[model samples]
Target: MVEADASWRDESLGARVRVALWLRDEVGEGGVFSKASMREAIKGTEQVDRRMRDLRPAGWAILTYRDKPSLQPDQLYLEKIGLPVWRAEHRAAGLRQISAKTRRYVYERDGHMCRRCGISAAEQYADEPGTHARLTLGHVNPHISGGGANAEDLITECARCNETVKHLTGVQMTKEQVWDRMKELPVQGKRQLLAWVKTDFRPLSPAEKVWGMYRQLPAAVREGLEDDLEALMRS
Candidate 1:
């Protein structure tokens, strides 16, 4: 077992490691605390909640009201601390280690785009201009315990979609906002979206598949091909 060599108050350690340290020191096993309190302690850092969720894979047993009905919605119970993440050896405790080959295969298989949103690498979001999407690999089911690092078990996702899919924090869009956008879709678009929703998979169209392939090309080559495609269409 690794002993606590550093204090949670140390700002230099990673956010996840500091969070583990904070929980260990401030909220020991069986201690109860609120999200606000945790955030207040770990000031100036973002995604404290997400960091807490990351500890679960390491064997941290934190529970919310949903898990323990007796607790208030704002309160969390620390059932157990699973790892001594403060130690160098356990720094990556409970995290999946994917092979380089597996990562490349998964990214290529998903067309180097976010499988959930179909946004290619370095593409800006329609709703959020100036924010380019950064792609990453996520488990097909983020909540699954001990999910494997196999290609079949992984999916390409943007950082935003990854956190949202993991239920790590609040989504950018609310239900009402999403419903409003859904209502604006054309009839055919609505039908297609419905089909995709039913299966929880959006099959890439021929054009999208080719677009993914084209996006993988070098920037200069992609620019040349863009002109070529336009010319070919005109021809």
Candidate 2:
């Protein structure tokens, strides 16, 4: 028998453990057990319901289902946490597995703004209540374009802009295209543009990254060398 944690006992852990063990023993390998069977085996409806909730929080039980009894299609089948290797395989595939620290670093690097529209994370929340902040890291070149999951290839963007650019066809645009677009904006628009650009402008290669960094030089520097910057790009 697996040892039950003492702290877990307060949260219907004993009932949950009984349910887990009962399912493990009676249910064949990879076989599905109905909720009704579990309730009967445990001998109480309320106890089974309470124990099922508790088991979920402890990660010991997973609710799966099969469509055998065609008439009553709503019944769920219970399975052990580790019964199917496919469960583990599917989980591994589904999990992005990015660490919290890495996520924070990406956010900090992007200055908490959307790469495409320059919307700050705070603005995104204010504009769309009940939504999370808009600091998502996205790939510069998609995986289809041979981009790997690396810091150099990732940049921050708001969810909307990220989704919009994700469907673009043909060759990926260069950072120069980004800068040229910025030049077309009015003062207020430019300010908003710069804010997002600063946050979401990481390039996929060291050379491109360097170019992007220089492209975002302070407004004062750009003002003094605006003509020169344009001329340099052209030549």
Q: TM-score of each candidate?
A: 0.63, 0.33
For candidate 2, the 10 contiguous residues with the lowest summed lDDT are 85-94
Writing each residue's lDDT as its tens digit, candidate 2 over 1-235 gives: 2342233222344555555556556673456656677777776436575454334333344443222343244454444453221222322221133567776677556555555555655343556676654456777753233234466667777766564454344434677996798789999999875775687433344544444344445557657676887889999
| lDDT score at residue 54, model 1, on the 0-100 scale | 85
The parts of candidate 1 lying over 4 Å away from their true place are: 5-18, 26-53, 61-80, 87-92, 168-201, 216-221, 231-235
Local accuracy by lDDT, each model: 0.84, 0.52
Q: How close is candidate 1 to the true structure, as a TM-score?
A: 0.63
- Highest-scoring model, lDDT: 1
RMSD of 1: 5.9
lDDT of 1: 0.84
Per-residue CA lDDT of model 1 for 1-235, tens digit only, reads 3357688888888888889999988899999999899999999999888788889878888887766789998998999998888788988877888999998888777878898888987788999999988888999867775678888889999988986676543455789999999999999999999998999777777888788777766779989998998999999
TM-score, model 2 to reference:
0.33
